[model samples]
Target: MDNQVRVAVADDHPVIRMGIEATLDDISFIDRIGSVADSTQLVALLDTQPCDVLVTDYAMPGGQYGDGMELIAFVRHRYPDLRIVVLTSMEKLALIRGLMTHGINAVLSKADDMSHLRAAIQATRTGRRYYSPRIANLLKALPATGSARLSQRESEVIALYVGGDSINTIAEKLQRSKQTISTQKVTAMRKLGIETDADLFKYAIELGLTRKKPLSD
Candidate 1:
């Protein structure tokens, strides 16, 4: 049927991928085209397996395409027409907002009922954005000093730092001056009210911003 939604699922957890695939299998209007366990397999799957919507985990490490915002950015750039639904356990509104900024179609909490996955797929299928109830509430309660207050460059700097890159390395990789990277890091911390490097690392981990495992090409 032309209206049937072809869906692909990607997650690092075997059980999560299985459960999501099982759920998709029972949906009348959806076709579970394929499922994979990492970003590498996902990239290969997408390269050949056409799908209408992709339901992927937010923190899937161990793929050549590093996870988090980088993986999302890669997929969005490589497959501009593919609709993406980020199924993550991440609760920080700022992190979620970062995903949204990269043009994802939906963000659903893993805590939400599996049924919400269907709703997310439906919403994305029609080109509308969807957020799970829990995520929506978090957005409603967004604090003024939240990660959303940080500039895009600040967010990038923080993610790279928490991922284990030094200031000089980040500056080199980002093609910015060391002073600019340092300022951005300090400004990001100030915006988030983090007074120390230790606090910043802890906050990044809490927000699921730790550096992902290195991508192996």
Candidate 2:
């Protein structure tokens, strides 16, 4: 195999994918093998031109609206050489764990770190597991099992908010808007049966979502 790595990027949003392309453009060794919007184009590209690595977004339309997992599974079985990395905003460990269980090469979130994206692609090319720093730290801090486990996205929001960052800060970090973050926080609180800031902070720690240090003298 050559030293230069071939990469295929699949995402529904044009702006983000364009940003990703620009980011990869700086890397001398990465060859932009293919770039496609939506899952249909990806399927067509995979059928005609195979890429060394497949970087895609979860919860996107492939077979239909929000059926990315099916396509991934199909690719895993049909094309064994295709190294798959789920590059998306979905931070739920459940979704990450599910995709990884199906033999994905790597699972990365758009929020925690972008530097890891390049590293993950390289790692997957060599047939190894590539979990981002946030994921590795998450696993180190939180267990996946038990009802205490919160979705990765939920934890992300809680971590920022509980850590004293405002909604706008969280928004900028996650590449989302303040309204979206506000709405999600309220929704997640309801789902977790929390009603106040104190309760939410307590829940975040109990779920191993954040590390809120106790006040010291």
lDDT of 2 by residue, 61-114 (tens): 744423456677777776777888887675554455446557875887777556
Best by lDDT: 1
Which has the greatest TM-score?
1
lDDT of each: 0.83, 0.71
| Candidate 1 stretches greater than 4 Å from native | 144-217
* Clash totals in order: 0, 2
| Residue 35 in model 2: lDDT | 86
Error of 2 at 147 (Å): 15
Q: RMSD, model 1, all Cα superposed?
A: 6.3
